[model samples]
Target: MSKDYRSFFGLSGPAFNKQIPAEAIYRYPHLEELHYYLAAAVADGAVAVVTGPVGAGKSTALRAFLTNLDPLRYVVIYVGYTSSDRALFREVAHGLGLSPSYLKGDLLNQLHGAIEHAWLGKQRSTLLVVDDAHLLADSLLTELRQMLNFQMDSATPLGLLLVGQPTLAARLKESQHEALSQRTLIRYTLAGLSRSETSEYGRAHMLAVDGDPDVFTAEAVDLAFQQAKGIPREIGNLCVYALIRAAWQEVRSVDRKVMGEVIQAQKGP
Candidate 1:
């Protein structure tokens, strides 16, 4: 049987796994900014748009933000996909513990009633977070715009958060989406980590797993920051791969040479 890298590195658990607890996630400055924007949006019961490049940790930041919200004061509904109008409504309905309707109009009415009830009756704010929102068609986006139309547009009973790639922001700027775009109160783009932040991120993950932070030499960490372009997901993957390479070579610490080999293998034809 192959040797376990975690054992070789003295890791108590998997490093860089998606299942990592929110408290264990490294709080980059950008993530803190996102949390602030989200908090403002929820407070105003308005719309917010967060966009970033792939592996920029947009979803991770959102997850951490939602985890800390007071459940008694907020009803969080997450929609991961927006393939169709009905599917979108269905997901929201399910989140509110209501059966989805077959007709589009009925579904809209159902959602409006449920959201309003949560806000007015229970005094709980309803936050609808749509991930991968860049894939939403213009018609579907119009549906989202209508969702925010409450009390003759004078009051906002629901908070809508659109999270996706940078293209989602550009798409919102188009003339066809002006109505929805105008309603967005907060907008922020997530940036990747800086050189120092990248090193800290790697070391933080190592410490979270009960492994030695210095298991990766300074040179190795530098190469990782460069090779991963400061993206957290990419940096994590590179670090894990380098650890495996170091274990295979019977090295106690990952050096520049080990990271280089891992990078080369990753770029293979």
Candidate 2:
């Protein structure tokens, strides 16, 4: 009978679970810089956009930033995959604990009042973060620009954060979004980890779960890194399956041969 992987590896817990706490997420140079820029933008109530390919840690970075925000002083509204103009406004209103309106103009007015109440009245700041903004239509992007124009654009009471893939940046550059483009205070693009960083990433997760650092051999680690192409999600998935393979064989460590088998299985015929 095959032993359980965690028991076989002497691990205290699962090393490569899908969910990693925001604070515990691995941060490289680019993510560190993104955090700094996001902090500054939040303080200024400015607009910031973060773009990257899938599994590049864009959402992870944003989660880390939001986790660090002081709940007493800042109100964070997070909307994912904004499909329509009304959906966007509806999300904002719902996030603020207010009734949502189907009318765009009414929604805007309601959002403005919510921001004003949160900021000027309560001395708190509001941050609205929209993920998968690339899916939003150009008209919806224009609506974002109009939201920033509240209070005559004299003072920024609402902080806007847009997160999406590389295509989002391309969309923003188009002439239709020119005004919104100009309003963007900070722009950042996240990249995947390098080979060395990928190895470190594996070790970090192992340690986080109280597993042995040398659970994966050097050759196995290299294979995982290469196959994952430095994407953290891919790395985690590869490593987890490699561990399972080792455990099934009643082995203590995953080596190159086991990694090769896992990779082959992943790329089925």
Candidate 3:
């Protein structure tokens, strides 16, 4: 049995719950709209820019979205990290299962071939998802501008996505990267959860854990959500702490008082 809420849930805080945690997960209130927009962006052969605060679920949204698409229907490449062209090349190559030795000469040709092979063989759409795009170095950012030149002569354009924190938007707005910025055909900044979403969010995780949704009282959820400030990570942390507190008290459910005590304990010097 899992020792605590951290073990019960995933350690990174609220990435997902135990059940269907690895599946294509969706959340309430505008999630469908966001889904629609991302799908449309990729279909339109345009790069989508997703930005959000620290705990805003940018990574989660992209991962969930990628899982929703059929692998045969969409060859997706997930790259998380820096702003280096060489690094980008390595990541793209790694995703494509290309050998690193191919970079000796005409490496771009190899990658273009890889892209073509991935696209034509399966007859599926090819998507490149780049996470933490704000850290992209200026050189690599420019490389994207150049890499856009790599589409097959066919009408279908390659799909590229940049997911990162809100600062990514500001970074794109910088004057130097204007050329690269202009290519971002779509942009979405995930908003934090609302009060209703917060309660549902808590209940959803509890349900995912196969625990009673009523394990957390409405007042308890409200206080936890307030302390969480609607951030998914924060909500998960507060809920876990509340659960530990309730556990110590031999209570199956958490009340506002128990939740408050946990919060206070966390903030105590």
TM-score against native, each model:
0.96, 0.94, 0.88
Ranking by TM-score: 1, 2, 3
lDDT of every predicted structure (CA atoms):
0.89, 0.86, 0.74
For candidate 2, lDDT tens digit of each residue in 203-240? 87888787887888889888888888888889988999
Best of the candidates, lDDT = 1
Off by over 4 Å in 1: 152-155
Per-residue accuracy of model 1 over 198-228 as CA lDDT, tens digit each: 8888878888889998888889988989988
The ten-residue window of minimal lDDT in model 2 covers 148-157
Clashing pairs in 2: none
State the displacement of the C-alpha of residue 48, model 1, in Å, after optimal TM-score superposition.
0.7
Model 1 weakest 10-residue run by lDDT:
148-157
Comparison by TM-score, 1 against 2, better one: 1
lDDT of 3 by residue, 61-139 (tens): 6666776887767778888896557777777777878775445346667777777776677666668888888888877
What value does the lDDT take at residue 48 in candidate 1? 96
In candidate 3, how many Å is residue 206 off?
1.3
Indicate the residue-level lDDT of 66 in model 3. Answer: 75
lDDT (C-alpha) at residue 129 in model 2: 94
Inter-residue clash pairs, candidate 1: none
